[model samples]
Target: ARNGFVVNGALLLDHDEDKLANVLPRPNAVTNRPWAVLGVLNGDYPRLHICDRTVTFGRSPDCVVQLDDVHISHKHCTIERDGNNGSALVVNHSSNGTYVNSRRIEGTATLSEGDDVVLLFDRIDGAMHGKALLGQQRVVDGRGYPVLVGYRVISVNLLA
Candidate 1:
């Protein structure tokens, strides 16, 4: 005689501030509702909530998710709100590249619920800071080649 039922998975709950922020766009206005949350598959970082129309992740301070991975480019990849359906779109803009579900992306990809995403890097150039020099082989064109760094997006939830 069990009093409770078994739930297969864990559910993480967080507010989407960006959706609330969009309501008034005023600097003084404070919105606490979050549109979506990205749970990291294997990392110490806390869950990421979608707090902007376009959320960027990379080594650069300008990026929303400023990862300290040497292999990551300055402006690696972006999660943007799709204009047609308000869905979240994952786009790769990194020299190292971005992967969704173990498959490398060509241009843009629509994210499905519980889809796996990985930020890939072959070699690291600390100087690039996420921006590779303009070339095919794509070297940092600076000093200090660092180690490889990558991130995996374990789960994604879109709420709008």
Candidate 2:
């Protein structure tokens, strides 16, 4: 008996690739372990990698990704690897707040590849400030703040 299948007239043998075919992993998602890339607004800052299961980003010196921004709280947010499937959980733990794709994160949020992860901060005037994704400039009030937006930090081709 043949232990294989065919799709679109292509033969798929029961090899290493076939064994893992059923499992659909995101193109850029981590396969064995969960990982993340933290890039500051624009290309001013270097791209930081999150290899550990747990990572903390805040103004505190002890934080894994420390920021000197006054708007950032000492203990801002944490990114935890949810499972071996490469999905991560981002938990907000600061007054400044956290946002994912322009929406405020109530408590925790699941992070995927290419998701827009925004870190918010409250200005003295009560206005909000935060780092957005690259390219997509955010419109703050009347004036169009050509701030950096979108995830153009890392090249997508490398992941594929």
Candidate 3:
């Protein structure tokens, strides 16, 4: 049973305090709760990066630098949720491109847990750590439906 989610950087450096510091704070704070954060260490720089409610284009967090010279333009991008089981924060590519796990996604796509999402613009890609399942889904069926029953579980994973 999982109660909380956290995203952390995978890169390990003995002296890199910034890397060790939790970047999820801002995202979590803006979102008004604790969430899972994905830590990215190596990859092409993304043009548009979404941290919670903030979007960073052609720029990295104050303490962090772009991994490479590649830059992505931030335009015509949006995030949406899929059905009741899946969710996605998507980028609508105009002239540039958006890639998820090396595959270029056009229009819309559902983001999974631990997916490498990148928005490409000007050869630079903004990297994002996708966090999923911040909370559980509780369905309360009060009559109407046939074979309806009531039960409670200590774990969200087991509810499904």
Cα lDDT computed for each candidate against the true fold: 0.51, 0.49, 0.32
User: Over the stretch 1-160, how does candidate 2's per-residue lDDT look in tens digits?
Assistant: 0233222223344342432333322343444432566544333333444446666666675665555566667877877666646466788898767766566688998866555555642243454454333345332211222232212122221222
Q: Is candidate 1 or candidate 3 better by TM-score?
A: 1
Model 1, residue 39: C-alpha shift (Å): 0.5
**Candidate maximizing TM-score:** 1
TM-score of each: 0.58, 0.55, 0.37
Q: After superposition, how far is residue 144 of candidate 2 from its true place, in Å?
A: 8.1
Candidate 3's displacement at residue 129, Å, is 24
| Candidates ranked by TM-score | 1, 2, 3
* Best model per lDDT: 1
Better of 2 and 3 by TM-score: 2
Q: How does model 1 fare in lDDT?
A: 0.51
Least lDDT summed over 10 consecutive residues: which range in candidate 1?
1-10
TM-score winner between candidates 1 and 2 = 1
